[model samples]
Target: MKLYQVRKGQFVFYKNELHKVYSVKPMFRQSVHLYRLKDMEQILTRAADIELYRPKHNDTFIFYGQRYTIDQYKKPEPGDYILITKPAPDLFDHYSLNEIEKVEEVHENSVTTTKDNGVKHHEYVMLVPGKSEASQEIAYYDKELVPEEQRLKDESISYLAEKDVTLQPYVGDIYLDKRNNTKAMVVAVTESEVTFGHGIHVHIAELLDEESFELIYRYSTD
Candidate 1:
């Protein structure tokens, strides 16, 4: 793991023991302060000496504020859309959905004296739904559903349209990008632009245009 990948409150392994990052100091050589999970003892380590803890099979972790379990890990190949939460060097600038044409794992010697073997690290890959695939799924659902069920769905959509509840996109809102029909979650909003995860930015006017994007879901604080 690189120094830039270390973030406070993230779980990592130091000296082969699970530890939580307590704090990070930016300096010529970044200083990472970690608390041992077993005994709560604070220890210091360098990025080169530690490894970002990889969850084992069935292990659970929060991704984008949602809890997910690790079912399996597959080697990433070309033209693969991978889901990643950690900072990947070139593939992702942030934790968001992205497509990578190629991926390679770089193995380096461990800086720690206790470990003689090198650490092998690679990007975790997971498949996500694409625009065409999603459209096909919706079409299949419409075809498979009974007439009464389809009628109910159509009526619900009409009812929502009749209500005319114009909802403003706020931070953390998830919407479907009508242009490509992919789901996106809002991360930031400005006067003229709205930014989504993975650095997707859209003009406020364009986002408000129903033809460009459709509001999917939003958490209610009430």
Candidate 2:
């Protein structure tokens, strides 16, 4: 509430949630404080209700009642999250599922599509997460390459791309490794390799292929 009463790192209830005070600043005649907030409820809600799935190399999964093989798996950058469901060639648009319905691992290849001409072009199938047989069907879109113009027209996608940080793997750049599903800062780099870690527990890996790794989070220079 009041700036003078706020202490750095103190927790306060604001905007219907708890926020930790980050820093205090004096601007002209008034003082301001920065707050960091985390919504555990929101995170848990998403975890309990929706899951995002990424395609792996050479993997095949059913979409819209059709089977699609991963022709090439390119890790999506942070900006790509906004447009995951948009049409893209050879890319399994990110899949989102609510907790109610489920998709099981594929044992055999299959393909299915919408039949009614009047219905919107979306395909769907519902399968038990453990069992192989489908219990219900849901609506989803088959893959297609969305036009660049249409992609740019999406305001959220455009906004994130504008704010995205582009960094070459360097000593400080943060890297997201799809293979391990982890994030680490590049602590050192050589002509053909990279080492990442904070202090005494460094891990070395081959120089990252730009085509396979994505830049999601970045370290700020202040």
Candidate 3:
């Protein structure tokens, strides 16, 4: 960890025990001042000697209306299911649940990504799940915060059907492709097919099929 990354009040592992950062003196080589949470014993240590305290294996939390357990804490690889939180949306994105094109780098508190313009955006990295599916077997840390029955009802296909949901895709309307879990905007709509900017062409008939696609955002002229 760099000196800039160390913040007072953050939890860290020092001397094999969880300690809270009490203060930092940048002028000194041993800048990180930590106090043991259990006994309040204070100690000064170098930034490189300590490790950030994060959720490890089996630690569970409610993320994006679903519960997940931390499988491990490591750098992310392609195709791996990781939980990422975007600060702007204040939501978690899981591989199986959300539209994530790719993960570039996973940091202790943030994930960095470079866009087409070469500007980087930092998003919070929550966890890497052993499995992407939400389970009732693992007790969630925030179970009391969000009831399981309510989450099930919200995500249920039957509940969606009851609303008589309809999609009328127009130019610039955004939709999610259920087959690959990708979001695309309608760039062109013809009698038979709807074309997206990324070269995705979907048959107009598929829009009616719930398994095929779902409307994400509607573009209105008004």
Q: Pick the candidate with the highest lDDT.
A: 3
- Which residue pairs in candidate 2 collide? 65-112, 66-111, 123-140, 124-138
True lDDT of residue 58, candidate 2: 40
lDDT of each: 0.46, 0.29, 0.50
Per-residue CA lDDT of model 1 for 1-222, tens digit only, reads: 544577765667666445566567768364888755433346777878777754444443222112233433544333322333333443312222111111222235111111111112344434332222212221122234446564344324234333334545678889897645678898887643567775456544335434447888885677
Lowest lDDT block of 10, candidate 2: 112-121
User: What TM-score would you give candidate 2 relative to the actual structure?
Assistant: 0.22
Instruction: Answer with 1 or 2, whichever has the higher TM-score.
Output: 1
The digit string of per-residue lDDT tens for model 2 on 56-133 reads 234333221123233222322211111112222223322221101112122122221110011111222232221123
- Looking at model 1, report the run of 10 residues with the lowest lDDT sum: 109-118
TM per candidate comes to 0.26, 0.22, 0.28
Which model, 2 or 3, shows the larger TM-score?
Answer: 3
Clashing pairs in 1: none
For all candidates, the clash counts are: 0, 4, 0
